[model samples]
Target: MKVFVFLTLLACGAFAQQGPQCKAPNGGGLQPVLEEFVALIPTDKVLELVLTAMTSDPETQAVMEFLSSSEFYQVVDLVQSQPAFKSLLEFACSDLYLDAAYYFNILAGIFGFPEVHNQTRAAARTAGFRGLLLDILELIPVDELKALLDQKLKSDYYLQVAFQKINSDEFGSIIEALQGDAAYNNMKNRLRGLGVDVDLIIDTISKIFKP
Candidate 1:
């Protein structure tokens, strides 16, 4: 009996030394909580809340803080895995995020998406920043996005920058990863199909998205 007990103890010790099986730290186990937080806010209300938090909250000076935070993005990715969550993000952002694309600058630290920063823009290019605002361009208004695009068309510098971002340029491969989710997945084109006039905005994006 004593020998058996000793052997059991040794086995337990070995297992402990092997360490707890790592779960890959997906969202640090906080995706559900973040999903809940997003669910509570209505689609139209999301922008309002972000704007409010940005304007009123001392801890977070801007919605861009939440949008670009890698931690926050992690949470968003996990929640986005759920169809319901993805649906909400897509619908809400269509009316809000795209319209508010000019505010991306405040979140660039979190939005750089370096993984595909060096990659070339895909043919359809339906993904990777379609409607998703970059950290640099998110801060400006639609009007500015248009003006910048206009300036770049004339100079050529802005066009290259936009190309780089679409093809492969950032660390997180943010452009690529964003394509996996709602903002860049398919909605931008849908909006255009709905007659949103995105090209007009792209023309301006060149000027404002300044590298």
Candidate 2:
């Protein structure tokens, strides 16, 4: 798994070296890079690798178990009970979501992926994804979901254990391997070219696992 991640990073560094071709499109930028990345490594294979790694790690298994616990359901219930959240769900079911979907379809067409555009349009019309979300919102019992948020915030055992695993030397070694000196420099330079604040992003992500 570590080897695969390291190779993937190296491939991305090579892609970063392709000067003009790596540039973002007229209205957007990341899509072209993403397309190139996807071309090199299929999305399904990436997802498979991620799932394999997660399932093989005991700490990740604990985190996944916690996510499916009753307490997590309480968290979901609390969020779903919020008027603001409900409003957002309603908005998603509105024409605005369709507009965004159409916009993405246009982008797919522009990027020379007619199959992607056609599939998206077909799914937008036939798939009941939006309808299912609306139904879930309507079915949630808001009164029952009115539990205090503090009750859920009190437990940090599983999260703390997960963070410990993330901050461990084993995990750090994996990160170091994936971010080898050359690959790290190349990524930073590429992100800078795209006007990203690499230091700020690194700082923000680093804080998440801080003790």
Candidate 3:
């Protein structure tokens, strides 16, 4: 009996030294658990919940009102009339911009995101300012004036320099105007009412994506 007890103790020590077996059971993994979780929530129900939340938010209403206001159009006009803005638009319509976008799409393709590459190519070619500006010109009766200004803007170096200088000096005035606008203030206050800590959200998102 003593010899049997000693042999049993020896076997137990050997098993402990060999370490725990970690073989997963057949058909057991994270895939089934994820499927089960997804099955618990219907897609339509999820959409309904998100839509309800957005519609109930006062900030959403405020944003809609601000978008429909005359002040918004005035602000757009002011920005578009600036020389720096026109320069930016000209750059957007250039081939160099398309080349940069093509490189970005290639990088996306390298990362196993072929859809992003395809969408980027489509958007860069069709949805850019070149096409949009042409469409707008066709709709309006300013084709001759637009052609004249386009020629002068492309050829006049001194005019471009003057506009760049004015843009640099008066950029702050844009912010000042927005700050004094009633619709802008109302939208800002409504967004503040959501009570979310913007900095905390940004920090958390940064940490999540940190390498």
Candidate 4:
């Protein structure tokens, strides 16, 4: 796993050297780099490696160490300092928030236990919080994101807290102001026009807000 992560980092470094403008459509895009990385290793092997590490305390500690190390920060700084990264970040920020909260669910699953959460948060602090976050904002497809989020939220306390916050009076007021009764009625009408059962949307929201 360490070898795999090291090689992956090396490959990313080499790829980033190509500068941001080489790929037109994505603008030095992450897709080709990710594809190349994926092609270099079999999925089964990768999964095996991940599972092995997850089962071994020493291996997990090694990973945690690497994550919080100065070397990792250097990599993060290099990535963030790149013009391509900045460009991609601007583009990502424009639409990223639509799905960004889903990642909290992912994190919550990984660090849901207080012991794990404290350890991970401490590591993140050592690694520099902003740098750690900016380094991992790559997007997944919406459907896949939703699926992962759904699975993670099943055992995620942080996600529950986040959802509760969204349902709280402060956030509710914001939501209400943004889409009050008239707007919701209009949305229901629009959905009905598109042959969608508006009740389904309402029911979903009702479940989300249920005490």
Ranking by TM-score: 2, 3, 4, 1
TM-score of each: 0.23, 0.28, 0.26, 0.26
Residues forming the 10-long window of minimal summed lDDT in candidate 2: 115-124
Q: Write the per-residue lDDT of candidate 2 for residues 1-211, one digit (tens) a residue.
A: 3322322222212111122221212322222322333354334544443355345544434544544465544443443344433332232223112111222233223322221111110111112223222232333332222221122223433323333444556545645543544534554464454333444434432332123
lDDT of 1 by residue, 137-201 (tens): 24335454345445544555433432333344331233234445564435445435433345545
Better of 2 and 4 by TM-score: 2
> Which residue pairs come into collision in candidate 3?
none
Error of 4 at 152 (Å): 4.8
| Candidate 4 Cα deviation (angstroms), residue 40 | 27
lDDT of each: 0.33, 0.33, 0.32, 0.34
Ranking by lDDT: 4, 2, 1, 3
| Model 4 lDDT per residue over 77-192, tens place | 44334443333323222321112112212322343311111010112212332222222222213244344445544665544444444445644443344333353344335435
Per-residue error for 66 in candidate 3, Å, reads: 0.7
lDDT of 4 at 113: 14
Model 3 residue 51 CA deviation in Å: 4.8
User: By lDDT, who's the top model here?
Assistant: 4
lDDT of 3 by residue, 49-140 (tens): 33443455454335434534566445444543444433332332231121112322332233222211111111112232233223322333
Question: Cα lDDT of model 1 overall?
Answer: 0.33
In angstroms, the error of model 2 at 155 is 49
The numbered model that scores best in TM-score is 2
Off by over 4 Å in 4: 1-155, 181-184, 204-211
